[model samples]
Target: MLGTDDELSYWVLVLTGPQRGKVWLVTAVGAYPYPYPQPEAHGFAEWVQHWKTHDGWWS
Candidate 1:
């Protein structure tokens, strides 16, 4: 449930937590075109890093 309107060209990140916790991280590429898909787009690197950084083997 993350996407930008035509008026705004940016990426939206939706992080849904357990038990209905949700977060959104919205940022603009600033006139540059983003060639990535929506779900696998923003915060993936950081997400992976954080996942490995904190939740190692706990999942």
Candidate 2:
């Protein structure tokens, strides 16, 4: 969940397997920016790139 002076936002993830299922969640809380829009747009590309770049590092 994200909270700001003006608005709030939240993110949730759920994963399921053949037998066992996994669930993950993340929350962000910060002050709203000068613009009235949401922050998800600004960092989305970077986030996806990073995820793809480092997602397999453990392997």
Candidate 3:
């Protein structure tokens, strides 16, 4: 899920997967999915990371 804090004016990211669950504080800056995974390594973390980075949740 994705949401924002009106007072703080920041974005939030919630991630859930088979391997783990995590939350991230996102900003409208930076590039797409800082750490991308290769075709051979498609783990849960990599899957979530790809979306988190490329999806532009902060935007």
lDDT of each: 0.37, 0.30, 0.39
| Candidates 1 and 2 compared by TM-score, better number | 2
Model 3 lDDT tens row, 1-59: 34454544332333555322434444465212222222232334644565677854333
Q: Count of backbone clashes for each model?
A: 0, 1, 1
Per-model TM-score, in order, reads 0.22, 0.24, 0.25
lDDT of 1: 0.37
Off by over 4 Å in 3: 1-41, 55-59
Give lDDT for model 3.
Answer: 0.39
Better of 2 and 3 by TM-score: 3
Question: Candidate 1: misplaced stretches above 4 Å?
Answer: 1-42, 55-59
lDDT of 1 by residue, 5-51 (tens): 45454333444543122223344544321222333232445444544
Task: Decide which is better by lDDT, 1 or 3.
Answer: 3
Model 2 per-residue lDDT tens digits across residues 1-59 = 22122233432222334312211223265433211243322233433454468742112
